[model samples]
Target: MPNLDLWTFALNCYAREGVETACLELQSQGADVCVLICAAWLEARGVARNQERMCVLEEVAAPWRHIVVEPLRELRQAWRSPAEQDEALRELRKTLKTLELQAERSLLERLQTASREWDESADANQWLSALAPKGSCRVALETLRNAAYQTQLELAGV
Candidate 1:
């Protein structure tokens, strides 16, 4: 019981009631407009392809140069054997972990850069006085001081 408007119905018709079919319909309609709409829909859905969702996802992701078709390909491979599926999952996990490390490194680098940019000759007292009106500043400063001390202690290993 969903609302099917003329556009959706038409797209559904274009989708030929399927992602691939709709895509083909759009293509048949005209490449330029179809590709743009298809691209937007794919991006919003975070759509990825695998054998099961291949027809739909491919149509959605086709407009982009680098489409995430791994899942779809893996799904098809997995259908033949469980071991292949496990391997695909393992590979995905490894890739995700590497991405996480890279993101953390980027975040840490940005934090260090911001800290350096804020560094000045101002003493703690002066900083506290200036920031006193904003009551939370002292607490934040104390937390930062504690973290710095901990870092120093860890470096010293004592």
Candidate 2:
């Protein structure tokens, strides 16, 4: 596997067809998109899944998602209607969207830093299943998984 960093890997996979919608569905089901992207990166890199490591990544991500990302996202979404009617509000909403993205990028960086030392093996693709929220939409998860697999192949020059 190529040694792409988490943020780059995430951007690649999330840009794939159907991945954004699948991720949004997963997010609506209470899954953290950042953590899910981290899981995809780990899977692509063949990093083995374990409770301890999952916990560690979640620990690194959850607080920031709650305190930083979500609030920005919520505010951005909340302003959508009003912003459509006001130029200044639209500009501020765009800035909020940028901040939300930056927050998510920071979370991905934290995840990558936390998992930097994990050993990789051939059977490490179980991360998506392990990290996905319970009762998540199977179709959405499958879409994400397939995109991640395609991303892995592309990175490997397959």
TM-score of each: 0.28, 0.95
Q: What is candidate 1's lDDT per residue for 1-158, written digit by digit as tens?
A: 12112123223323322334333333343332222232222222223323333233234434331232334333444544454558876676566555543543333333223222222222222221221223333443333333333333333344
Q: Tell me, what's the RMSD of every candidate?
A: 24.7, 1.1
Candidate 1 global CA lDDT score:
0.33
Q: Candidates' lDDT values, in order?
A: 0.33, 0.89
Window of ten residues with lowest summed lDDT in model 1 = 124-133
Model 1 Cα shift for residue 150 (angstroms)? 3.2
Candidate 2 lDDT over 101-138, as tens digits, reads 99999999999999999978866757888889999998
On TM-score, the candidate that comes out on top is 2
- What lDDT score is found at residue 36 in candidate 2? 90
Model 1: residue 101 alpha-carbon error in angstroms: 1.0
